[model samples]
Target chain A: MKAIVNVGLKQGVLDDQGKATHHALDTLGFKEIVKNVRIGKQIIIELNSSNEEEARTEVTKMCEKLLANTVIEDYNIEIVG
Target chain B: MKAIVNVGLKQGVLDDQGKATHHALDTLGFKEIVKNVRIGKQIIIELNSSNEEEARTEVTKMCEKLLANTVIEDYNIEIVG
Candidate 1:
């Protein structure tokens, strides 16, 4: 099974990278085109799980334990066969 | 409008970060659980575009020009109202 995780900063959390990117875009003539930008990370994991349920459970645990900083980040997990 | 872009290393490219994470997971007792892991970036842009089509076009250009390294990265863009 394959698990895709999208991890992002929680709402209201300050994102320095995003801010820098936003500024860069504006300087590069994308100011009027873009209002805001936020950046995050995506992790794709291939596992030897038997089913989607097992994959989801294990991947979620992985996120909780190591993949994400839950204190200021939010993650969504999607499992695929 | 909102545009979401997922940028990942091209197939066959060596991803040092992914390899490090994979090794870390194994050392953390997730060896049998995960077979492979790849990491990428997710960029979300909120734009003042009129519709999804316009948003998609501009965001695609952004990805091609500044958001991703075309030589070694592949990017997927999705637009949302």
Candidate 2:
């Protein structure tokens, strides 16, 4: 089975990388096209879980323990088997 | 309008970040649970495009010109507004 974990900064958190990229887009003349930009991380995991529920549980644990900093980030898990 | 640009390493390309994270997971005793792990980036853009097609075109151009490294990364766009 395969799973995708999408992690992003919590709303209202300052994202320096996103700010820099947004500025870059403006410098590149895409200012009028893009209003805002936020950057995040996606983690794709191929696992040996027996079922979707098992995968989701294990992946969620992983996220809570290691994959994300819960204080500043939020994560969503998508199972794609 | 809002759009999401998911950018990931092309298959067969070396992903040091992914490899490192995989190793970390193994160290964290998730080796049996996770077979493989690949890391990627997600860029969320809020824009003022007139329509979905327009948003798609502009976002694709942004990916090709700035958001992604086409030679080593592949990106998918999802408009959400």
Candidate 3:
């Protein structure tokens, strides 16, 4: 089984990295087409467990304990075959 | 329009961050269920253009020119409504 975890900042939180990237894009002549940019982390994990439910549960726990700072970020976990 | 770009290290490239995270997960008692981990970046962009084709084209340029380190990284762009 495999798990994909996407962790991103919540609304209202300032994203410094995103701001920098957006500024860079504007400087590169994309100012006319770009409105805003936000960045996050994508974690892909291969799990030993074959059960989808078990993999999702374990990945969620991992997110809470180590993968994310729950106060500032939100994460979504997807379990795949 | 919105674009979701996932940038990840190509196969065979060493991902130090993922390795560190995997190590931490093992230390936290996930050794039995966690097989491997790979980490990447997800960049979400809001575009001034509403057309999906136009948004995708501009965003792809952004990825190629600024968002992704094309030599070692691979990126996928998804245009969302």
Candidate 4:
């Protein structure tokens, strides 16, 4: 089995990387861009759990423990094959 | 309009972060994990283009120019209303 975890900063949080990209875009001729830009991280893990339920449980634990900075970020997981 | 850009190292590329996370997961009591792990980035951008087509074109350009490291990373974008 496999799990995909996406971790991202919450809305209203500052995203310096995103802001820099937005500025660069405008400089590069994209003038109609807006202000809210946020960046996140995705993690794809291939595991060998016995079942999807166990896999989801373990993956959820991983997300809470090591995959996400829960203080400022939120994470979601998708189980694939 | 908005676009989500997901940037990831191409398949078979070395992903140190993923490897580290895998090791950590195993150490943290997840014993049935496999070997291949990949880490990626997600960038969400909000723009004010006149239409979806224009937004897509501009967003694609941005992905090519600055959002993704074209040499090592592949990026895909999704527009969210």
Candidate number of the best DockQ: 3
Estimate every model's Cα lDDT from 0 to 1: 0.91, 0.94, 0.95, 0.82
Backbone Cα, N, C clashes tallied per candidate: 0, 0, 0, 0
True contacts kept of each: 0.94, 0.96, 1.00, 0.90
By TM-score rank, best first, the candidates go 3, 2, 1, 4
TM-score of 2: 0.97
* Tens-digit lDDT track of model 2 for A1-81: 999999999999999999999999999889998899999999999998869998999899899988999999999999986
Least accurate 10 contiguous residues by lDDT in model 4 chain A: A29-38
Candidate topping TM-score: 3
Write the residue-wise lDDT of candidate 3 on A1-81 in tens digits.
999999999999999999999999999999999899999999999999988888888999999999999999999998887
Better of 1 and 3 by lDDT: 3
> TM-scores of all models?
0.96, 0.97, 0.98, 0.90
Q: What lDDT is reached at residue A32 by model 4?
A: 58
User: Which ten residues in a row are the worst by lDDT in model 1 chain B?
Assistant: B49-58
Per-residue CA lDDT of model 4 for A1-81, tens digit only, reads 888888998777788887887777778877557555788999988878758888888888888888898888999888888
| Pairs with backbone N, CA or C atoms under 3 Å apart (clashes), candidate 3 | none
What does the lDDT read for residue A10 in candidate 4? Answer: 77
TM-score of chain B of 2: 0.96
TM-score of the second chain in candidate 3: 0.97
How do the residues B1-81 of candidate 3 rate in per-residue lDDT, one tens digit apiece? 899999999999999999999999999999999999999999999988978988888888998999999999999999988
Error of 2 at B15 (Å): 0.9
**Which portions of model 2 show Cα errors greater than 4 Å?**
none
